[model samples]
Structure formats: structure tokens, C-alpha cells
Target: MSEDRISRDTEVLVVGLGRFGSALAATLERLGREVLAVETDEYLVQQWSHRLPVIEADATNPEALEQLGAEDFQVAVVGVGTSLEASVLITANLVDLEVPQIWAKAVSAEHGRILRRIGAHHVVYPEYDAGARVAHMVSGRMLDYIEMEDGFTIVKMRPPRETHGFTLGESKIREKYGVAVIGVKPPGEPFEYATDSTHIGADDLLIVSGDTNLLEAFAHRP
Candidate 1:
């Protein structure tokens, strides 16, 4: 989906109230978007209904989606990944409804390819993404990490001792370590945008960006 595809003021239709679906719907609501969630499991529908607007229904049936006015929604999210048949059927049904932006969750590459073939605008691998993010955090000084396309990454981490007490220009971090320090947050101050004259302090937090392996090497420094 394009960056401007989903506006904060837009209403979203979410099918399947599983862990991923419920979390996404709740987050969208928190972000000031109206969300209408549909679920096949009665218990799940009931459980999440109090948190957001939800109804119990089988989304695999195109007729059911038509009744629910799915076509009226500009964005639709199919969060059924456990059952491949169900996932594919729901995504296909959304396509038939002509939902302009469809985001489907896939458990495997094959499922993702199928969703894309059927016109799903976006496919998410939540499990794999979460595992990768956790793997990075547990193995290094990184407090947080976001892996981007083409091996690039942005990380929040503690400053290395080699960088302590030196101005960015003097340290030449990007030239030496191959990672750019984008921002810094001292122990109690607001985050500061990084500049050539910015001094690296011992206890400051750093937001760094670079190739993933280079980031790992930089973060591993003493």
C-alpha cells in the first residue's frame, strides 16, 4: 500500500479477531481511526466487542461480506493465517468486494504469493518480523531495532565507550564505523537531533542507522 493509502480519519474493516487482528484493530482505534471488526469465533467477537465494534460472521462467504458492506471500506485487513484455505478464501472474498487496500497476514511464502496474486495490496509476516526484532535485541546492546529493506536498519542503543566525550565531527563515526548517528537522548533531556558539533556523552542513548551487519559491528564496540 502507498504511504498515504490509510489516513488517520479513515474507517477500516478488519476480518478475524485473532491476536494479530485484535491488536491491529485496537491500535488503529487508539490512533483515532474507526474500526469495524468481523470475526467467525463467537467468543472472540464477544471478547473484543467491548474494546471495539465487532460482529460474529464468516468472512469466507462473499455474500456475508456483501451484507456487511465490505466494499464501502477503503481499507480491509484479513488477519486469518492459521488456516491456509480460510486465509485464501477470505482474501479472495475481499478482492471480489473490491476493497481497494487489502492487508493480509501470511504464515508462509506460498500463502503470501497467493494473496498477492489475488490482489492483496500488502502481506505481513508478523511472526517472522517479531522474531527477527527480538533476535537483534537479545544479542547486542540495542534497546530497539527496525530492519528495513536491502539490509538497512535503524537502532536505539547505548553509546559505545569509543564515542564517549567526543564531538561527532572529531569522532568521525560515520567515516570510521560506517553508521550514522541520527539522534541522541541524554539521561533526562528531550531527544536531540544529531549534528557534527554534538558531543557524545557516556550515558546518552543513540539512534543509529546503517547496514544491518555494520550496525551490529558498531553496537558490539566496547
Candidate 2:
């Protein structure tokens, strides 16, 4: 979805209140958006009912979704990844309702592809993202990591001690390490993408992306 797509509506229908769905609903509500959550788990529905409108029903059932005015929602999220069949069916139901945008959580790459084929506008692998982040934290330099397709990654990290006195042009990071320095956020300064003249600072956080092997090489010291 385009960046502007988020402006479509603040009302979001979150189907299946798993960990991801529940957290997403809560966050959206905190942002002052209207959240309507659906779940088959009666206990969770009861637990969250006071916080938002929780409908206790099967989200895969088109009848229940339609009754809740699913079509009126600009965004719908399907987070039932445990059961592949159920996740696909629920996504299809949301599509049939013509929700403008749908975000679905998937357990694997195959699941993600299926979700897209069935009409989910975006599919995410939360477990994979979390795992990559944790791995980067335990490693060196990497403050954050985003895994991209084909074993590529975008890494945000503090400039190494060796970079304190060098300008980005002088650093020759792209030439020396084969990883692109996409952006930089200096201490007490706004973040900006790279240009030859941008001076590197001791406290700056550099954003870079490239092959996983190259990123690991650039960050590895021992």
C-alpha cells in the first residue's frame, strides 16, 4: 500500500485477537483510532471488551463480518496465522467485503505469498522481524535491523569509533564494504539520507542496507 493509504480511515477491523492482533488493536486505539476487534476466543473478547468493541464470533464467517459492517471499515487485519486455512479464508472474507486495505500476519514466506494472492494488501512476518532484531542486538554495532528479500537487510547503527573523525565521503564505506549508507541521524540533528558532503559525527546513527553477508562483514570485528 502507498504511504497515503494510512489516511483512508482511523477505523480498523482487527480479526483474530492473537498476540499481534491484540497489540495492533491496542496501539491503534491509543492513536485515537476506532478499533473493532473480532475473536472466537470468548475469554479474550471479554478481557478486551471494555477497551474496544470486541465481537465474539468467527471472523471467517462472512455473516458475522458483514453484520459488523466490515465493508465500512477502511482497513482490516487478519492475524490468524496458526491455522493456514483459517487465515486464508478470513482474508478472503475481508476481500469479499471490499475492505479498502488488508494486512495479514503470516508464519512463513509461503504463507505470505498466499495471503497476497488472496488479496491481502500487506503481509508481515512478526516473528522473523523480532528474531532478526534480537540477533542484531547481541551482535556488534547494529542498533536495529530490517530483513529484506533474498537475505538482504537494512541496518541502523551508531557510527563505529573509527568513524568519529571521517566525513561520509572520506569513509568510503560503500566502496570498502559494499553496503550502501542510506541515511544518517546525528546527535541532536534531524535524520537525512546520504549525500557526499554530509559530515559524519561521533554520535550519529547510520542507516545502511545491502546483502546480509556484506552487512555482517562490515559489522564484524573479531
Identify the leading candidate in terms of lDDT: 1
Tell me the whole-model lDDT of each prediction, alpha carbons only. Answer: 0.92, 0.86
Candidate 1 segments whose C-alpha is farther than 4 A from its true place: 1-6
How far is each candidate from the true structure, as Cα RMSD in Å?
A: 1.5, 3.2
Q: Pick out the ten consecutive residues of candidate 1 with the lowest summed lDDT.
A: 1-10
How far residue 200's Cα lies from its native spot in candidate 2, in Å, is 4.5
As a TM-score, model 1 comes out at 0.96
Best by TM-score: 1
lDDT of 1: 0.92
> Could you tell me how far off, in angstroms, the CA of residue 145 lies in candidate 2 after the best superposition?
0.9
Model 2 lDDT tens row, 1-222: 454766744688999888999999998888888899999998999999988899999987899888988988888889799999999999999999888889999999999999999899999999988986888867888888887789889988777666676877888888888888898898888999888777788778899899988998787743
Tens digits of per-residue lDDT, candidate 1, 1-222, equal 464865767799999888999999999999889999999998898888788999788999988999989989889999999999999999999988778889999998898999999989999999989998999988889999999889999999998898899989998999998999999998999999999999999999999999999999998888
